[model samples]
Target: MDNRDAVSAFLRSRRERITPEQAGLPVYGQRRVPGLRRGEVAALAGVSVEYYTRLERGNLKGVSDSVLDALAQALRLDDTERMYLYDLARAAGPAPRARARQREVRPAVRPSVARIVEGMPELPAFVMNNRLDTLAANSLGRSLYSQMYADSTCGANVARFAFLEPAARRFYADWERMARFAVGALRIEAGKNPYDRELSNLIGELSTRSDDFRVMWGSHDVHVFRESTKRLNHPLVGVLELDQETLSLPDETGLSVVVYSAPPGTAAEDSLKLLASWSATTGQDQHTESASEPSDRHL
Candidate 1:
């Protein structure tokens, strides 16, 4: 999982997606490729062809911020894509600095964070890492994603569940759209943390196990999860159209708290109330079952 390969693929993908006309460049006769040629992009960015060629070859080392900005402008990169490009360049810096940037991302949730999630009894809230692992979840959050939790194969990873679980298709109303967003988000994380072994393994596993993931991963799209509406078909509570908000922790832990809520006076709101009640009842039953288990001495 060399970062060079990622850099090369991302640049080429972005380049090949744009046409000369899109970039307001005059097209020459019989263009071999659909996108603006390297020279055209270089000219647009006010860089020499050789320099842009060197960048496209994945050697972003010692790249300047102004040049990166110029490239981003020439490529028409959106905010998220621009951030990803900057991250890739930073990762391409000196070995010691890059290593310093690669800090160990702890998967454990802080007690205060867990308490905050638990305190939000009305909303389904969970804490997740950059890898899309649901590290901690409130009772309602767990209930909301019961299908994902039931399938132990993904180990509570959202990306894995979306790609690897068959039930996911039925669980999400807009399966294809959600899957693409998930893929895009994962791609962004990969760009930020290229040295993470767990993330690499997760991407490799998804690529190997799911054809849809493999195809979507090839697009080189990027996304940052902020706020979105998710239409979910829960087995227990039926349809739930919830608005999800992702808030990043202030620290460099790469952890975020995702909270889902429904608008008042909507059917989704009614469903959430019912789901909360059901979650409470089920949780009590599980607690009772644990308490009633026979002791080792008795056995």
Candidate 2:
């Protein structure tokens, strides 16, 4: 992906989303385009129209922090959006420096992290990378997301399961909202790590396969994961309203542990208990079947 195109699209998208009145600027008779005009944004940001146009054209290279801040304020960007703009600017530095940044090593799930996931027997917990690939999961986590695992085509990727698998539409009660959040989060990652080949490939796959993904991705929205409630329709346990928490690893490995839990004394909590029992039973059955199977020697 071209950094310039991304930078240009992001800035233009943000600018076009805001109206002149919203920016506290006086509106003239009839507007030729949506949102505030380039001159209006330039005036608001305390920059000349020509300079603002240059920046908007995707030449964020050598842009100062203060100028970025001014543009952020003029565009009424949220915290996440402002950070994205800064990331884009940082990426637009000297070619050699940007190339150095491009060579990233994929992080592995450390033994301690695996242990932490396994330690949570009662809760559904898993570790995922920036691309939402399920690196590891506890027994209950695997059971909770069995449908995603069943579809090998998804490659244990959350976004792929959501966009490519039809079952995901039913599994996630609020599919549209969840899908948008996923797209937005991926957009933020792209801005920060523009040259991530795996991430770019995943985005390309989703865009090609899912029309819904295309619309959401085109929105250029950004999101940072936080504690939220997710309603999942588990095939085994039925509907479960679980609280989701995402904890990022301190080592900056781009890996996050996601845990799901339900409040005590609620139906959702009861369902979780039933789901755990089912997982255990399923494991036992698989073990027994495997043990009883005839060996190749016998054949």
Candidate 3:
């Protein structure tokens, strides 16, 4: 997508989500649009209506930081969204060559990183790139995401499984909420790595195949996947409520380690133990099956 189109879409989406009352502006007349009018936004941002209209039309090439910040405030944008605006502006500038070089370098998890994941047998740990591709996972991690692994063609993308796979509805307790969060997180990644070919291809594929994905993508939402509480409905062990922590691998650029854990002496902890046991058994079965089928097929 062109930088102008992305910037315009993002600005319009943000503008369409804020009402006059929400922005502390008086409702003067019958509104044609759902949210703040262009004139109202321009007034709030201390800019002319024509200038704001130009910005909303995707002319962000020479936009100043003060102007962007004022626009962000006027739109009531969150931190992620504000940063995304900056990213869009930067992408519209003369940085395409640097971005292209970065995209050409594919990120990989180091052997030491894989060993770290393996060492965390008690916790469900996995390494993922910015695209949410599971580069490495422990046995428990693999078992926790069994549904995603069930479809070999889908690979190890969390976003793909959440949006494109029907089994996700059964796996995630709050499937719709998780789907939206996944898409938002993907959007944030896209903002950071605008030239990533794999990320773009994955997004294009999901947008084409999944209506839910397309809708979420159109929202222009962005989120940081730092830490959260996730509830999962495991097919073998029933429900599990786990605390998820995402740690960035400093040496690996776009790579991160995601670990799921439960507090001690809680029912969630017991469920995790049961899941570990089940994972062990499933691992053995998969090993036996590997002789006949492809060894790379996850359990």
lDDT of 2 by residue, 1-299 (tens): 56898888888999899988899888769988998788888999999999999999999999999999999999999999999999899878867455546445667777788788888888988888777777777878878888887744222777888888888999999898888878988988888777777778789988998899998999999987663899999998899999999899998567888999999999999999999898887782121011111111100
Ranking by TM-score: 2, 1, 3
Question: Which wins on TM-score, candidate 1 or candidate 2?
Answer: 2
Model 1 ranges off by over 4 Å: 96-102, 105-107, 153-155, 284-299
Candidate 3 wrong stretches, greater than 4 Å: 153-155, 282-299
Candidate 1 achieves a global lDDT of: 0.80
**Sorted on lDDT, highest at the top, how do the candidates line up?**
2, 3, 1
lDDT of 3 by residue, 219-265 (tens): 88887765489999998888899999988888887788889999889
Q: What's every prediction's RMSD, in angstroms?
A: 5.8, 6.1, 3.9
Error of 1 at 181 (Å): 1.5
Candidate maximizing lDDT: 2
Clashes of each: 0, 0, 0
Index of the highest-TM-score prediction: 2
> lDDT per model, in order?
0.80, 0.81, 0.80
Work out the TM-score per prediction. Answer: 0.90, 0.91, 0.90
Candidate 1 local lDDT, 76-172, one digit each (tens): 9999999999999987876744553454435456677878888887798878777777767777887888777764422278787788888899899
Instruction: Score candidate 3 by TM-score against the native.
Output: 0.90
Query: On lDDT, who's better, 1 or 2?
Result: 2
